[model samples]
Target: MNITLAQAEKAIATAKEKAKAIDAKMNITVVDAGANLVAFGRMDGAWLGSLDISIKKAKTARYFDMNTGIVGELSQPGGSLYNIEHSNGGLITFPGGVPIKNTKGEIIGAIGVSGSSVDNDHTVAEAGSKAI
Candidate 1:
């Protein structure tokens, strides 16, 4: 199932809260199960460059139905997924991407956050995903 606009807004709201809690200005993005953009939020003072990065991160997560960090690990030198990022028109294989799952544990969408450290980005994205 795809993520509805309401759900996407909820995710963005939650991600914004987490970003504020950590004193991070973030660009948050959400995508449906089909890897289509659903909603986005850019906090005041957030890095302009991170806007695209956030969107790519969410799309990347939905594309693989897994965290981008995991993708990053597998894409390391000599790893099985090495060079995978080069495919898909470029992907952010680092942190800040998380799949959004429903109560039935079905992945419905994904959330991605940027403009902070990788750890913080992941944390915020995780918070957003859980909101769904």
Candidate 2:
């Protein structure tokens, strides 16, 4: 099953609303289950550096089928799956990434956001996921 553009648009819209509410510019990325890009958006004043990081976070979520924050924990110094992150093109491991699960509880995609604090990023991504 493929993720529809409409779903991606909904997620982006939700993210934009949340980011605006917090007065923070943001870079947002959405990826399919295979980690392919679905959609992207950057607020007017978002940092350029966040573009790549946001995409990487979504890819990381798709690759692991889990949130990037959990991936970070697993890839940490003493964690069991530490070295796997290095093999997947070195995706960013952080909390800004979240899986988009279908009603069946299957992950259909993921969302990622950057250009703000980690907490804000997570908030935006969560809002996007709920919108979808």
Candidate 3:
């Protein structure tokens, strides 16, 4: 099943709260299973660079049907599918992107965030997913 607007809104709200808690502005993006954008937000004062990175991370999660951290590991030197990272607009081979799974463990979409440390980005993304 596809991600609904309600889910997107929940994700955005949670992301905003987490970003506020850390006192860090952020760019958050949600993408459907097919890597299509569902929703996006740029917190005030967030770095412009995070705009693109957040989308790329969401796309990475959507494409891989898993967290971007797992994809990053798979793309490391001597790892399988290392070349895959070079495709699709150059997704960053790092953490901070996470998949959103339904109750049956099916991935319906993903969320990503940037404009902070990778750890903080991951925390926000996780918060968003949990909110959904």
Candidate 4:
């Protein structure tokens, strides 16, 4: 199953709310099951450098079927899945990415957030995932 347009919009809205709650300007990106862009939102004053990071975070989560933070944890030096970020044109291995699952527990899409600290990014991304 893939994420519908409405779901994507809902996710973006929630993400924006979370960012605002934290007084953060964020770049949020959502992607479908096939890792295609579904929706995106950039809060005012968001860092320009985070645009691609947000997209790549969503892509990374969808590509691996795991949160980017988990990937980052296991991808550390001498850890499992290490060094694979160098493949696929270099993937983001940090936090701020999550898979969106359907009611039946199927992954439908992914959400990514950037333009803040890693902890804040993860928090905002998790908020967006709730819209699934």
Best of the candidates, lDDT: 1
- Candidate 4 error regions (>4 Å): none
Off by over 4 Å in 3: none
Runs of candidate 1 with Cα error greater than 4 angstroms are none
Residue-pair clashes per prediction, in order, are 0, 0, 0, 0
Candidate 2 residue 77 Cα shift, in angstroms, is 1.8
Ranking the candidates on TM-score from highest down gives 1, 4, 2, 3
Q: Which pairs of residues have clashing backbones in candidate 2?
A: none
Which scores higher on lDDT, 2 or 4?
Answer: 4
Candidate 1 residue-wise lDDT, 22-89, digit = tens: 99999999999999899999999999999999999999999999999999999999999988988778
Q: Each model's RMSD to truth, in Å?
A: 0.7, 1.3, 1.3, 0.9
- Give candidate 2's total backbone clashes: 0
What lDDT score goes with residue 12 in model 3?
89
**How do the residues 1-132 of candidate 3 rate in per-residue lDDT, one tens digit apiece?**
878878988998999998999999999999887889999999999999989999999889888777788888888779897867679878865777889887777888999899999889989999998886
> Scored by CA lDDT, what does every candidate get?
0.94, 0.88, 0.87, 0.93
Residue 24: error of model 1 in Å?
A: 0.1
* Residue pairs with backbone overlap in model 3: none
Spell out the clash pairs found in candidate 1: none
Best by TM-score: 1
TM-score of each: 0.98, 0.93, 0.93, 0.96
Q: Is candidate 1 or candidate 3 better by lDDT?
A: 1
Compared with the true structure, what per-residue lDDT tens digits does model 2 show for residues 1-132? 556789988999999999999999999999887789999999998999999999999988888787788878887888987766677677888789998987778888999999989889999999998886
